[model samples]
Target: MDYFFAVVAPLAVVIIGGCTVRSVKIISEENEALVERLGKFHRKLESGLNFINPILDTVVLEDTLSERVLELKPSQAITKDNVSLIIDAVLYWRVIELELAYYKVQDIEEALRKLVLTTLRSEIGEMDLQKTFYSRKDINKAMLRELDDVTDRWGVKVTRVEVQEITPTPKVIEAMELKRAAEFKKQADILEAEGTVRAMELLSTAIKSQSNSKDILQFLVAQRYVEANQKLSESPNAKIVFMGSEPLGSSMGELLNNSTISPPESNGSNSKSK
Candidate 1:
């Protein structure tokens, strides 16, 4: 009985070793494999232990179903304003239907890349440089929606689309900065003029209410004159001029009174005159 048991044990070990080496497969978690029987689709080998007919079944492809990131290179695009920009993006995607992904597209990665680039350029061409900067989220959502529609048939689920960078050309950047500075300067000048007008109105009201208004006005004018001299003294080639505070105050009051705008004549009066 011992001799028979020893012979059978050796034969069993050989058979088990051969099966383990050739037929058995361990598919990792989150991974899948496709098998073909005589060059025809047989079955999908899912995660965990799987056995295949060593002679007939062959693994055609193995891939993971996990989410993946595809980073796009900076592509040059012209905005609606004809401003050239360099933009890059990232795509979060995953294969929902492995069979469709493998058979439908010859090269899935290349197809997705081209599709994304085309969509990005199309969206960018619809917006100006300023809109492109402000509407970043809108562009991302639009791309995601557009890509999802097209890639649905390709078994790709684009989870998220992100615009990583949108940068204008160096010359465009400099021009934009200059334009912004001009806008700021114009705003400042308008505010300063409005403030001066408001101050003159307040001074006119004070003069009407008080008897010593002339003395107060002359003192204010002298203070402004000193401030102007101090600012001019900081300049490399400043020419200082001295003038009496009383004359300066009188002239300032006359200038303020003359700053009012005359209203246009009534249309009825003009017609009657004609």
Candidate 2:
């Protein structure tokens, strides 16, 4: 009987000591724990020393208060224009309610990831390829709004959603580049034509406003001839030849005489006539 009593007393003391030590839990400042009694939710254990029945209560779920980042794998989605694109994103979230985070959703992170992917696909499907590139902020805001609303019940707050990369297929990218080039060329041509029209209008106005149109016309001809010679001189392959300016002079005289403005008679010819 003495041997039996000694053995049972030591075993009981050891069990009680173990239970006492286990009942006192020290939680970190940034962490939370979900306590359950007999597999049923009892209460949430906050940061610092928390006590619970060692046999009956268990800390089933433990999570951090710090932000968590989840990087999504690249997902393929089609734009409104039917252009296929691959997009990947990163999500920033934190557990707001430990009980709902554990009890409401079996896997909060996975559910949040799927929600983001679905929302992203839907948003991308609504926009054209060009708009998708420019409207990234709008898309992110929309995703955050939707995610916050849906994830609220799960006790997860989605702080931010960032689209890491949006890549169109190689073929689509090539096509887009070509299309942009064509559009740029078209705009350049239009601008050139508009400038030419404006220049012509200004020249016509200046010519009409002149009192001596013949003098203005002669000046314009000489300026153009000088410009042409300058361009020919600058050309690497151009062959410069010394040509007589007599023909040009005669053509200018003829053009001046045919003009509506009468040329002033020379003083020498007038004195000789007098």
Candidate 3:
């Protein structure tokens, strides 16, 4: 009888002590614990030592309260222009309410990833291929807003969404490059034509202001001759033609003569004075 009491008493004390210790849980600063009594939610366990009924209470869920990052796989989507593209993205989220996070969603990360992908596709579908490249901010903002609304019920806060990469097919890329080059060339041609028109307008004004059109005509003819000679000199086998300026000189003389021809009234006044 004495031996039985000594052995059984120590065993009972050890078992009871272990149960008493388990009644208190030590939760880390970055973590939260959910307590359920008889399969029903009783209270939440925050960071530090928490005391609860060992026999009646159970710690069902323990989740980290820190921010989490999720890198999404490349997903294929179509733009409003019907161009297909591959998009990659990243999401930032955190659990604000441990109980809701555990009970409201079966899989938080999976749900968040799918939400981000669907939202991305929807936003991309509303934009053209060109706009997708530059409208990343708008897309991110829209995704964050939509995700926050849905995830709020799950006690998940969507902090941010980032578009990592957008890749069009090889053929689409080539076509885009060609289109950009053509646009640049078109702008260059427009600027060149505008410069030519402006030059012509200025020349016309200068020619009208000058009394002796012969000087301006000679300068223009000489400049053209120099430019033509220079261009011909660039080729080794080029033939240089030295044409006379007599045709240009005769045309200028005729123009000057026509301008100097006075009215009949001025001619009659001069004749009467003489």
- Candidate 3 all-Cα RMSD: 7.1
What's the C-alpha lDDT at position 16 in model 2? 97
- Candidate 3, position 120, lDDT: 96
lDDT of 1 by residue, 1-274 (tens): 8998899999999988887777888899898898889998889899999999888889888899999999999999999989999999999999988878888999998899999999999999999887998998999999999999999999889999999999998888899899999999999999999999999988777665665665566677778898987888888887767667778777888865665433344577655553
- Residue 44, candidate 2: Cα error in Å is 1.0
Predicted structure with the largest TM-score when compared to the true one: 2
**Which should have the higher TM-score, number 1 or number 2?**
2
Model 1 / residue 6 / CA error / Å: 15
Steric overlap count per candidate: 0, 0, 0
The TM-scores of all predictions, comma-separated, are: 0.61, 0.64, 0.64
How are the candidates ranked when ordered by TM-score, highest leading?
A: 2, 3, 1
Stretches > 4 Å off in candidate 2: 1-5, 177-274
Worst 10 residues of 2 by lDDT: 261-270
Per lDDT, the best of the predicted structures is: 2
Candidate models: Cα lDDT each: 0.87, 0.89, 0.88
In candidate 1, list every pair of residues with a backbone clash: none
Q: Candidate 2 on 79-133: residue-level lDDT in tens?
A: 9999999999999999889899888888888898899999999999999988988
